[model samples]
Target chain A: MKFTNFLQISILLLTLTFLNYFIVYQKCPAVTYDDKTVIHQLSKQNVNEKIFFITPTYSRPVQEAELTRLSHTLLLVSNLRWIIVEDSDQKTLLITQFLQRISKMKIFENFEYTHLNVETPKSFKTSRRDPNWLKPRGVWQRNEALRWLRENTTEKGIVYFGDDDNTYDLRLFEEMRNTKKVSVFPVGLVGGLMVEKPLIENGKVIGFNSIWKPKRKFPIDMSGFAINSQLIHDKHDAYFSPYVPRGYQETHLLTQLIHSINELEPKADSCTKILVWHTRTEMPKLKKI
Target chain B: MKFTNFLQISILLLTLTFLNYFIVYQKCPAVTYDDKTVIHQLSKQNVNEKIFFITPTYSRPVQEAELTRLSHTLLLVSNLRWIIVEDSDQKTLLITQFLQRISKMKIFENFEYTHLNVETPKSFKTSRRDPNWLKPRGVWQRNEALRWLRENTTEKGIVYFGDDDNTYDLRLFEEMRNTKKVSVFPVGLVGGLMVEKPLIENGKVIGFNSIWKPKRKFPIDMSGFAINSQLIHDKHDAYFSPYVPRGYQETHLLTQLIHSINELEPKADSCTKILVWHTRTEMPKLKKI
Candidate 1:
């Protein structure tokens, strides 16, 4: 009788073990979707060209806030690669970790990205007292992106210098995607004008409406233009200059890429609509006490 | 011998059960901190008054983006009660879910909030054809907040109308906290002027320097003023008027709350600093095609 009781207890224990495993399996199923699935979905269409938006970012109090805002806008576009170059001595753990988290999100999983860092030389760095307009920002970082495009990319794409703080319309990407050589559009709230636009007459680039300094051959902000990757690769030595006069970075780079003014294609309904803004966030005052 | 063997097996099974429980406990511990704990820490140090920041928010494409940015600012402040009144037919699941997630964050858990909704009547609502400036927005919602304040609280607090779209400096909160009767400060990028500030002379509110319609008794934007809660409570019937002319809501309400110009206390380094801007975000153009 004692042997019989032992057999019954063993059977009961075995039944309990199976029940527990079944419950756990029911509660915790495998995750069906992941980063690879998103990428597969995006690649299925097989688009010919993509937009490589190169944004040179740096760390500050509002760094994450600005990046978050910009990311929301960038994620809305399809067939785009985000290349974020950091102005740091090395690839910091913060940015690496940030990119890892962003890549895991549903919104960013499908988008291709390359996170790089190229530190600015001490002599080239601007001080707080210096006016922002005089600072030669994003010089080395932009060059790194250009170098990356030349080395790694053979596929058709367009390169755009998208600032972390600037506002962009989805329409701007469509214009840039259609560019054969270079494209220009109106940037609002910039250069002391309602819009620093490419003055187009009868579907040709004529002049500019930049009130701050209209005399420059290409008077525009960094957010005002885009260039085809083929053109960027063709002009091997073309890069933003660190020694240019105040507000001449756009003109200096454009002059190197384009042979004549006709190469500039005015977009956004012949440059009438303002699709981007050089909007800068005012630094917030933090009290230590 | 059989009975002895059964006892040994039973003891072994019991030991395994205890070990399993221990492993589960180790793997999944209870959350150490929560929203209630954060609120407790903030309220531990008792103060004479608190700040009641009333914000009237509506759903738009940029609603979450703007609120996230604003929450970053508002969360940094202590002793603040965020009254977010939504402009909708009913309290939305989206807003409620957003608030639940936000309130649980480490940064915002300390702040208290009330999420309320009151839809605008069809007649008073602005159409797409009407310019944003011409439409009298936030009238009924502001009054709903006022009613909530009167019905719910008896404690001494300061009330400030914080628009969701505007940029705010942390220093602005400190300035608003020091107001006795009513406080006014310079608002940046407002009324077609660099600053819409009060013209103070020898510590008196003489007049305003508003470029647009400076003739009004109190020519200021919604973000330019903060009033004592007692003054709002004392004048029980005072609320924003829906029938008021365009841009007259500020003047119409301030007229009821204050008896004389001397009652206005100028803060933020005697109103020289532009701590807040009436900054508006341009709508992004999305292609339906």
Candidate 2:
């Protein structure tokens, strides 16, 4: 009876040892990078104000190329939630996989993203023969992002339209984070001018120096400004409309949100700095191989 | 005497308190991001195999745009040291400012880098009159990068030629990191083919599926393969030659380091996956203002 009891205990000990060593070695982690622990270990103690970056991307030759470049710039930003609205009937697998790639990295796991898509109507898309300014691009796509913001988030933060093709200086993000209302800054390489920005006098925006459409109410490029996210919820009807005449998309959206130019907050050292550029990629010509 | 001593003690305590809190707060960190501490805190516990990404970039209409996109892709990858060799007489401020922006980002502060520049002689540069394939691109710039590696790096790692204009999947970086001798993988949209790769016969690479030049021993895109850093040191005299006939750049340098096909290790699941693409950005058209 003593030998029998000893044998039973020995078997149980062996079983536990096997489970602890061999079995655990075979066990795979559900999360490979341990992203949460990494963030907890490395993230800043002070919580940062989140920024919603809205980009309306399309399926052109440079689509993936443009998005890939923009993703790098945004990854540097700590508390940004990217809203990429595709101009297609359904989200392309190409972009879906691209965002997944962005999310899985351990270093920038702190970066947040949202992928949404809304097709641009055929009527709104300009043909090759049409002038570059004939039709406003990314009209409905920007609206989709705003809709996503209203339905999904109640958090108060800044919302900036970050076109994928544009060049952004990291300082621009820092300058806009403390915005209480719409913040305006200069945009480089825009509208047949070296730079375009609102005229600031005594810490107030008096008007814009946009050469193309100087008479428009809010004469600015889509990349020129950022607004408070709460204003989106307050003014539910404001959005970029395709029906608006050429060069009025900025005005059409702004008039609905603010009554006067005094509400505009001048940033980037009172709009003396050009922290972003309204640049576009030249189309590559490829004959079918 | 007692009163004097008490006053002296109070002053000492006040000075210490100010130095610890207010003075420290006002003191700017010489390195604003504390890159070293950030890396020590957030870097992977297991040291990953380092990858030396060598890119040769030149001044073009779309120079910054291409580099910006590529930088984002590299930002996600861990344990990578980018060696950017500019095709210019001196390093430009545009690229210098760009690299500074990358270094200051907290999450990717762990990234290692070296920037060098060597001007491509005017004779080697392509003009509108020349065919795309008439002149070999990035010959001297790549050699400059190789020279930099030999001078600085003694560590064993993987060396790859990452052109600024190509598209890369993050997974490709992982597949090549474990290279013992050399690794070959499929490149998409290369050589006027849907994908280009070395054809495998039974677990070994017997030949390549290159339609452009089937006879060349190592018929591959510049983005197709990576070699061990030790090989670069072992074959110290082996360098890319400008005199090598068109489309023989890969073969010229590869033949010097590797003896036969047996030395090549197939990666990305036996070269079945297309993780990189040889896509080029179309030149953007901007009429002078």
Q: What is the C-alpha lDDT of each candidate?
A: 0.74, 0.76
Q: Which stretches of candidate 1 lie over 4 Å from their true place?
A: A1-289, B1-48
What interface RMSD does candidate 2 have? 16.2
Tens-digit lDDT string for candidate 2 (B1-289): 2555545645665455444443333221111222332223224333366889999998865677567667767866667898999989999998897886665442333477899999878988889768767898899999999999999889878999999888787678778887887899998777767778998977789899888877898998899999889999999998998898999999999999998887889998989988787777555444465
Tens-digit lDDT track of model 2 for A1-289 = 2555545645555455555444333221111222332223223322266789999888876676567667767765667899999989999999998897665442333567899999889888888778767888988989999999999999878899999878787667777877877889998767766678889999999998877878888998898989988899999989888788988998899999998888999998889987787766655444365
Which 10 residues in a row give candidate 2 chain B its minimum summed lDDT?
Answer: B25-34
DockQ of 2: 0.10
* DockQ (Cα-based) for each candidate: 0.05, 0.10
DockQ of 1: 0.05
